[model samples]
Structure formats: C-alpha cells, structure tokens
Target: MSGEVADPKPGKAQRRRLSRSLVIIALSIIAGYLIIQFVGQIDWGQVYRSFGHVSWWQVLILVGVLVLRQTLNAVPLATFVPGLGLNHSLQNDVAANVAGTVTPPPGDVVVRIAMFNSWNVNPVDGMAGVTMNMLNFYAVRLLAPVVGLVLFTVAGLERHRVGWALLCALGAVVLMLILAMVLRAEDWADRLGRGAALQAQRFKASADPDKWSAAVNKFREQMSDGFTQRSTISMLALLAMVAVDSMILLLALRFVGVPASALSIVLVIGTFFSAYPLTAMPLFGFGVLDAVLTAAFVEESGLHYEPIIIAGLAIWRAITILGPLLAGAVTILVWRRRSGSNLNLWGSKDTAPTLSEA
Candidate 1:
C-alpha cells in the first residue's frame, strides 16, 4: 500500500531562522549606507566648533529635560499596567527606545513585549499596556500641529505650511476615531482578528484563528477596563512629554545662536513631529530627520546657517538617541547580572515564544 507522505516540520524552524538572518543582514546594510551618507554631508570642523559654543549650563538643562521626558513617557505604562512601578516603566521605555532606534517598525513593541514577558507579566496585559501608550503618544503627536496652528494664529505669526498641517491634523483625527471605534466595539475587534487570521492562513503563515479571536477579545476587554480606570493622568503625562521634547529642541536651537522666534520654534518643532513617521525607519530617522529639520528651519527663518543647524541637530540626537541607547544598554546588562542570567537583547530566549507555541 502506498503511504501518504507527512510534511516536514524541521524545515519550518530552519526556514524561520534563515529568514530572520536575512532580514537582520538587510537592515544592517541599509543602516550602514545611511550612516555613510550622513557623514559625507557634514563639515567636521564646523560641527566641532559649534560644540564649543554650547555652555555647561545648557548641557545640564538638556540632560534634565531628557530625563523628565523619559519619566513622562513612562506614565502611560504605569497607568495601564497596574502595579507596574515607575522604575520598571522607565527601564522598559529606555530599553525599547534603544531597540527601536536600530530596528524597523514595531521593533519597540517587540522589545517591550519580550521584556514584560521576562518580568512575568501576562501576555495580553503587556500588549494592552504597550498598545494604549502608543496610541496616546501618536494621538498627541498628530493633534499638536492643529494646536500649534491655533496658537500661532492667535499670536499673529505667519502660518507657513498651514495647508499641509491641516491635512495631517485631519488624517490624525480620522485615525484616532477609527482606533476608538475598534477599541470600543468588540465586534470590530473580532472582525479585525478574523480578517488577520484569514490573511495569515492564505499566506501559509502559522496562526490559529480561535486563538487570535480569543486574544483580540481579551485585548478589547483589557483596554475597556483600563480606559475606564483613572487614565486622564496618563494622557496628560503623555502630552506633557511631547511638550518637554519640543522645549528641548527649542533649547538646542538657542544653543546654536539661532535667532529663531518663538513662532518659528513652534512651527519647526511641529514639522519635526509630523515628519517622525517618515524618518523613523533609519535609526530613529537619524540623517533623514536632520536634513528635514534643517531645511524647514532654513525655509522658515530665512537663514543659511547650515553648519550651525547641523551641529544643533547633532547635539539633539546625541542627548536624545545616544544617551538613551547607552542607558538602555547599561540597564540590560545590570538586569541580566542581577538576575544571574545571560539573556539576549530582547530578553530571555523563551520570553518571546514562537507563534505556534504561543
């Protein structure tokens, strides 16, 4: 009798590993290329001189602002994840910031999920906390332009690029409305889960429809309960965090001897915030953001201080990106040592279990 052949399962894990390696290699190549491009555009001597102009007091203020910004960013996590202390939240935020800088979209989320899992948090709860915090952060970012426009008009300043700002604000509103509907309506969440499961199945991806549906339902329930809790404080903290970051940017410009007006500063900050989604892919949009911000500042201020602008941006990135990255690396090392474990960057290997196993 002819026997039916069983599909090989060992090949599946091998394929996954191979695909992951390929992705890592591709990302590394892209990052290296972007770094080279950025370096080639800078004037090293001018940048070095600009650094000398910044006072120690300014550096201290920048450091303080960065710390406050990070602390504020952690509030939403503490709010969503009951019993998650501020220290844990800050640690998670810093670590995610480091990972997200190097990885592509949703990299921060992956790192946070892995960290939470290692901390013994329930998977669904961890996801809920991260999702809520992300939604709050984006909502504030999208709405800021509209708020800035209103303030600018009241302040009697020229509203440059108002049209683009309005369009982005409207889009943000629409997205927020859709997210609200999805979170509030269990049926919508269920439909989304079912559609996702169907798509995964069609792609021959490993997924369980029942599990997906259950997870979605659980997420909705958690979100609903969490929102009903004292969430206003968390939302406000998120807004404050954005404001603090903008202030830091404004200070950076001042340190560069830029005679930018308050209105110009607001608009420039708004532009930077709006351009985040575009520039976020390459190391937290390192080179791309610097270029965009420099162009915007030049266009708005009508100044040609290219070297100074570049230097200011370099300082800003140093404090925001490099500082956090170093802190996060140290945090990881300390945690591993304290736990007496040799976990990888994302956390213990078992923390992020395979999809099939999950």
Candidate 2:
C-alpha cells in the first residue's frame, strides 16, 4: 500500500451535484423574475384585439410558407444521402426541431445523427452533410445584416445603426475565415482540436489529444468532400430557405396590422440575423426570443404597437416552434409503432436499426 493513491471521496460527487442544482435554482429565479416583469408590462386585451385583425386566408399563407421552408430544409440532407427520400428527410427535420426545442447548440444535429444511424447512413457522411448545411445557414444569416446595412444606407435612414450591422458582418467574415483554415490549411484542424482538448483537460474533463486531432481532421476532410460535391446547390437552397423564413416573420407582422415599408423589411431581416443565436437556448428560446424580437420591432422598425408586436411574435412562435414540435412528436410515435423499436430520444441505450432492418 506504500505507493497507492487515496480513493476519490463520494462527497465530492455529491457536492458537485449540489452546486449544479444551486446554479439551476438561481437561473430559474432570475428567469421567473424577468417573465413576471414582461407579463406585467403587456396589455392582454389589446393583444387579443390584434389577433382579430389577422384574416384566416393570411393564416393559410403563413402555414404554406412554413411548409415550404421545411421542405427546403431537407434539400441539403437529400443531397448528402442520395438515396434518401424527401418524406424521410422532412420527418428527420421535424425530429431535429423537436430535439432542439429542449436542448441547446447542436441538439438538432444530435437527433439528425441518431436518425441517420437508424436509416443506415454512414455517420461521417451524415455529419458532413449537417455541418455543411449549418455553415450555409449561418453564413446566409450573417450576410443578411450586411445586405440590410446596404439597403439602409441607400434608403438614407438609420445611418446610426450601421455600426451594429458592420459588427455582425465582421463576425460572419471571421467565421468564414475559420472555416477556410479548417478546410484548406493542412494540420490546422488537428492543431485546433488539440488546443481544445488541452482546454478541456484544464477543466477536469477527459480528452485524448490524438483522438480529438484525428476526429477534427476527419471532419475537415468530410467537409471538403461535401463542399466539392454539393456546395452550389446546397448554398442556393440554404439562402432561399433563410429568405423565405424571414418573409414568414414579416408576413406575421403584416397580418397583425404592422404597416410594411422598405425600412421595416430591412430592419426585420437585420434584427432576426442579429438575434439568431438565441435559437440555441431551451424551448427554442421561447421567452428570450420574444423579448429580443419585441425590442427589435420597437427600436429598429420604430413600431410602437406593443400589442401587435406581441401578437405577431406569438404567431411566429406557433408557426416556427410549436408546430414543428408537435409534428416531430407524431413522427417519433409513428416510427416507434412501425419499427417496433425501443428508441430513446434522450441519452440512453440507442435502438437504431441496422442496415438490413432499415
């Protein structure tokens, strides 16, 4: 026993759990306080009245736009897996959207990967496709702010907000530069992975540098292959999807009697581009997203119809978040019944079907 190290204490694990619980409680309290404040400021009667202004035909159009957006979303996946049908792709997208509502960054990707595995798709190819799609998605979002900045300058309005647009443009450029380095610079991805692993180790996480490096290199290679194979079509589809989705939001505002103008359109797109990162939050960023969008509507668009803005936001959330969540749940249930597989969406034993079964 001379050189034996002392066993780790059970109390340390319990203490870590307690610390996590306390942090969660503190965050919950803060969020609850904010929500109470937001609710107190709103007039429910006006919000209800605003909803009556939106016509049933307009609601149909909004639903159609959302359907089209979802359809376009599956294009990149179909490109990645040539044999995959559009219906399956749509189901996967819905499943991803559902998972993303509950989890943070890359939750959609996690669900997609699991779905791909069940469908007998190669994991590397699946990851490559998802990464390429996400890259294009964010690229378009970042670029939109720049376009809005140009539009604003041409319109001779909101010159003061140019700095914010420029900042977002710079962020986009930085992201592109990092992507280029990962794909084109030999060993750069590996080095970045090793550095990340080193940082993780400092936080008491177990990470093998060599393994991380290898994975990064593989990811880069797959990305390179995907780009070479389907970049043009995928990028086009992604751009179109973003544009249509933004239009959906604009239409929502219009339905609620928010007068549409060139400046308003530019502001709407720009505001969405800026607040896009909020989607990484839980429940598809429910309260946080509404607050950000409401602020943007008032400040960016100079709209003072607080009730209309709140109502429009509710419609937007219904179309984008709640609808997909419901559809995804149905899809999962159908898959379970048909496959008779004991699949778990959350972390548990994976019941992904094999190639033969799929």
Candidate 3:
C-alpha cells in the first residue's frame, strides 16, 4: 500500500511539472504563430524590391539609428524601478534591456534575469511588481496619445476608426489604471489574497506567514521614506524614459524608409500599443510592430505600404528582442574568460573574482 501511494505521488508531481511546461510552450507557440502570420502577410518580395531602391548610406544610417534605439531602450526601466542612485552607469543595463526586449514574455524577463546576475538582488513580488510598472507605463502612454487622438477625432481629421480608436485607447487607459491602482494598493491586494489563502488554510491548516508579513511591512516602511524623498527624481526619470521610447519610434521609422514626422510616428505607436497589448511577443514583434506602424502611418501620413517601413520595423523588433539576448550571451561568454574575471553580473568588483583565479 505504501509503495502504491508513493508511486502515485511521483507520477502526480511529474504530471504537474509537465502541465506547467506545456502551458509555457503553448503560449510561446501561439505568440510565434501570430508573429509569423503578421509578417508573412507582408510581401517580402515587395520589401526586398524596396530595399534595393534605397541608397546604401541611407540603409546604413537606418541600421545605426536602430541600434541606438535598442541601446537606449532601458532608460525608462531604470527610471521607474526607483532603487539605485543617479551615479550608476547606464551602459550594460541598456544592453540588459535590449536582451529582455529581444527575449520573449514582455522583454522584462530578460531584464530581470540580467538584473539578478548583475545585482544579485532577488526582487520581491516578482511579476506582480513588473505588472505594477506596466501599469505606470501604459497609463501614461494611453493618455498622451488618447488626448491627441481625441483632438484629432474632434477636429474630424480621421475618416473612420475614430470611435474604435477612442474606445481602444480609453479601454486600455482604464485597464492600465486599474492595474496600477491594484499594484500600488499593495496592502489591499495582500489582504485579499491572504483572506483567500486563510480560507483555504482552514480546510488544509497551513503554516502562517504572519511573521513574514510583519517583516515585509517593516521593509516597506523603511523604503517608503526614501521612495517619497526621491519621488520627484524618480518621476522625472520616468518621464525621460518614456520620451526615449517615443523618440525611438521616430528614429526607427526614419531608418526604415518611413517619413520622419515625429507627430505621425508617435500617434501610430500610441494607437497600436493602446489597442493591442499582446503584439509585444518575441516572434510576433516584428510583424506586429510593422502592423502598428503601418496602421498609424498609412492612415495618418498617407504613405504607401511599401515594405521598407516593415523591414525597418523588423530591424527595430530585432534590436528589442534579439539584441539583448546576444548581449547577455556575450557578457556571459566574456565572464567565462580570464580577463573579465573581476566583473560580476551586478557589476561589483568584490563579488566576481577573475576567471584566472577560478
């Protein structure tokens, strides 16, 4: 009887792990499918034909600009996270952002992993904290564009999609705002979760985390003053970071053979991210970004749907998705070498000894 019981336990554990893995794989596959379908819809032959039409120098400039946009992508994350002082170098962190953007699952995963390696600090609340940050991000994003779109609609600029645009932007803004409130309302979230868990505990009689909760409260209190003290700094940094993202959109379009109109590109990005959140997938990013830009530009700017902008969007997507992965791999590779021995993932001299010593 004991042997049979033990066998089922192992079997059940294996099944649980398998199920989790399958779920992750399924989500990844779906993301990949959407990306492919979107990009495949683009006429690659047309893109290549347009590619041949552009001057070599213009092409090179576009590529270089794209790289800069990728490199700068991390500024907003650094601004919003609200830890670490102004003295920190932004270089490698930029690379980390590039990696996260390059990798799947909101690109923040890559950023977080690289952060763990570099800083050795395991963030509490994990994805919940990230979701909180996203709340701040899209809340600002949805509003700015929304104001612009509403004005445009009121002015009777758009022929159609005005209601759709307003509804999409408004809905996204509301969603992001709710998430932000939920995230910032940390006590409320925890209390609700704790209540549910406690109810379950009555059925199963679980170990209490009251002590841990106490410790967390203490830590939060300790941090709150510092956060408040630097709230202005943090918020300004955040604003700049968002500006960087907006600028990147403009720059990427310039590189991609799209017209370099700031207002137009911003509106396009505003519309897409406002409406479609899931388009930020790794495999699907290039295609989705293309659609976003295409939707915005073709409608607003009266630009023809030549595939160069699509290619540029592809390049922009590459910077965010593939660039950081490549950078992280390279950093790891170099860390495995003798000369880079003193550096740690956190970039502290004390923790990582030289590879030669190892």
Predicted model with the maximum TM-score: 1
| Model 3 per-residue lDDT tens digits across residues 1-358 | 3555433554465467567656765776565446545433657787666545546675456456544554344344444344532222243354445444333333334444444435433344222234434544454444444544554565555534555556647865677444334335568445645665666677767735564344445334433443433333433444454445445555556655666553365464455434343343544433444555555555555435536666555555655556546655665455346233332343222333331222
Candidate 2: what lDDT? 0.69
lDDT of each: 0.69, 0.69, 0.47
Each model's Cα RMSD: 6.0, 6.1, 8.3
Better of 1 and 3 by TM-score: 1
**What are the clash counts of all predictions, listed in order?**
0, 0, 15
lDDT of 2 by residue, 1-358 (tens): 6999755554465467557656755664467347535544767799899999889999899988988988888887777655566787788878877766554334466567667766767756766666766776666556655666665566665633567667767876787778778887658998988998998898857898888888788878766665645756765786677667778888998898888752277777656655665555544456676676776576544535767877887898788867778888888778767756565554322333332333
Model 1, span 179-229: residue lDDT tens: 667778988888878878988998867887777877777778877764745
Lowest-lDDT window of 10 residues in candidate 2? 347-356
Provide the lowest-lDDT 10-residue window in model 1.
349-358
Query: Worst ten-residue run, lDDT, model 3?
Result: 347-356
